[model samples]
Target chain A: MATLIRYALLLATTAVLQRLLLDQIRIADVAADGFLVLSVATGVVAGSRRGAVVGFAAGLALDLMVLTPFGLGALSSLVAGAVAGSLERLIVHSARTLTLAVGFASAFVGVLFFVLVGSLLGGVGLVDGHLPVILLLVPATTAVLVLPVRRLIRWAEAPSRALSPALR
Target chain B: MILLLLTAVTLLTLSGRGFGPLDSVRSAVGSVLAPVGDAASWATRPFSNAWDSAFSHDDLVAANQRLQEENDRLQGQVTQSAIATEQLQELLALVSIPFVGDTPVAHTRVVAGTAGNFGDTVELDKGSDAGIEVGMPVITGRGLIGRVRLVSASRSTVELVTGGGFKVGFLVIGTSAVGVAQGDGDPSRLRGANIDIAQPVTEGQIVVTAGLRGSSFPPNIPIGSIASVRSDDAARQSTVDIDLYASTRDLTYADVVLWKAAN
Candidate 1:
């Protein structure tokens, strides 16, 4: 389907950006998580299942460049995307403040979940003592990304679905 | 979503248990993306540099002033080197001992570093094809970087000293203080524990590699400087903190010591 191909391209593009470009752009030594933003954005517009799937694919692509357990990245992005996507049920607006709020919250919460899971799995180093910055940045980045991501999802998804009442 | 989570958890468990398939997946994925990552890294370098330069104007001014002072000092050293060159000929005749820290090395540019915030590894442009091997210490002009961890024909991964898995035998320079220093997941600092109780300690002292028996690093390679020293008399030891001199944020190139020569 066109949707699948579209998401596949997005996944690869974001992964490449995160792995190659954004990784080097550290603000205060903390690199912005590009995949996290896209994953949350996809979930916000495409609904939970698609969001989770896109996030997992993106996360797997990310795993190739990182040293975490094979699926750890997948898990983090999956939870974030899934939870954020599911929020579409509560709010009707797909491409506005509602989606941004969900995406921002998802990015922040998902990273917290990642750190918590990492700590439990003996990856305490993953926390890195920059909890405040990481937490703040994830959502801060999400805020910047929401509008662009919404437009991207609208272009990628079926026109009718994208143009539904909630999104308008 | 639940099923996906379960599947991901399963994969993590399997990888943690050392599953071969997972290794293959990781290797294959890494190999496939390494080039892409390399290209991307190479392409974005300008933006990264621009961002840093644009933001660090004051630091640049200070650094420029420092460089001016160093240039003046080096000119003096150049003058002294000519006179010292005459004495060195006589000293060389008297002593045939090898000089410390004169090892031959290969300088390579970093292609791709770890993408996220957590991992402290980097991909080098050179690899086994260039005679870079595992266990070789990587350094920059400033100080220690890390060591080669994984290698391929044309690319290799350097596990930075700040990585969670790295540990180094540490020594406080110009003093008898010795201890174990390991990364605390922060690139700017290392945690030093179990300093010898008898060795006197103080703030702002330099720290270097102890390079004890069986240690990978050569003796006395500068690592960082002591930021603080706190004593724990009950445990008969002191904890020291080291401030890393080499900034990982700006690390662009490193020299790999081939380790064939002791010096």
Candidate 2:
């Protein structure tokens, strides 16, 4: 029960931060990938189930705020959470390098998937001129955000665990 | 089991058959989350405004004085021009083209934007109560911005030309070649496609909205100017790069055109 509440809080906080602070910061003309980073952190700390739940909730929240087709964010975040959770089993410690790598990789795949799906939906026009700029900014912004997000997840998760004796 | 549920929800949403359960869930969640989005946008407003004010202070002051003088001089000219234009429009109204009604402009406050992607859509403070509706064209003196896509009681979402889902039909200035101008998910860039290669389009040619059959937008709204043209020899199609005239980065208020086409 405590773990569930923790996951819920984490999801809510992630959504808030994504809209507030993280969304505002633009590095290399790209805002930091807050939800992606949060998903990876939750997936790694908790099991895949928790990761999936958090991702779904966060993605759904994002979709509601954004004007895109409703399910796009949920689908992408679900995949991202599952993949990150699976990778967490192989890694022992939450080193900065590992987090950075995960952040960069997930950010890349997430953005690419979004663009591909968006293009297929017949709303966006494709042009070669801005592709290079997008390519450079996506990963770099993700890489810079890993450590801060890792710390935030830990902080947010600690309170829920404290409230639940079972978690202790 | 979880994946199955997720897939089911996704499929339902993609089909667009109106998912009541999901929409309720979204609205519930949005209600909870809306404050956060509002706070985020609110926090940034001051800084963005301050930065813009700093950069444009001298020029803006100078322009304001010049504009005052120009307005005084152009008052008579405008009256005469309005009469002449109205007469011409009345004559042209005889043609079977859909008539665009007079539009009233409204100013709105920005609410939120997309966080992750290059596209920056804004939620406005006005909605259905203010006579704003979906498909209403948004513009500034410089050029076209985008259109209202979604609306709530007190809020509306504008999908700027930089957003993924924005498309407009435009005409090139020199040859009047008509093509489709669409958002590239980047504010600074636009793409004009399906222009005939031999249309005499050139670099720096201004592009204006070419109202489609039954389109909500009026004819000849400024869109952008052509930057480059790419022609494929065998495909018989060409693409033109356009620089959007609207500055999405600094936009705070916009004019929501409330014109409806008279049948």
Q: Write the per-residue lDDT of candidate 2 for residues B27-139, one digit (tens) a residue.
A: 45545666777787778879977986989899889999999999899987888978986875686577654333344766787766654554557777777778987678888
Each model's backbone clash number: 1, 0
Of candidate 2 chain B, the 10-residue stretch with the lowest lDDT total is B95-104
Model 1 chain B: weakest 10-residue lDDT segment is B92-101
Chain B, candidate 1: TM-score = 0.76
- lDDT per residue for candidate 1 within B1-263, as digits (tens), equals 77878888998888678676664555556667778876787687687678769998889899999999999999889879878856655664485523224667888998776768776888888877889877788888778878886666677788888877688888787787888888877878888998978898898998988776677877657789889889988999999888998877656788888773234
The CAPRI category of model 1 is medium
Candidate 1 clash total? 1
* Runs off by more than 4 Å, candidate 1: A1-3, A24-26, A92-95, A154-168, B14-31, B34-62, B75-103, B112-114, B173-177, B213-216, B260-263
- Among these predictions, the greatest DockQ belongs to 1
Q: What's the DockQ of model 1?
A: 0.51
Candidate 1 overall lDDT versus native: 0.77
lDDT of each: 0.77, 0.69
- Candidate 1's TM-score: 0.80
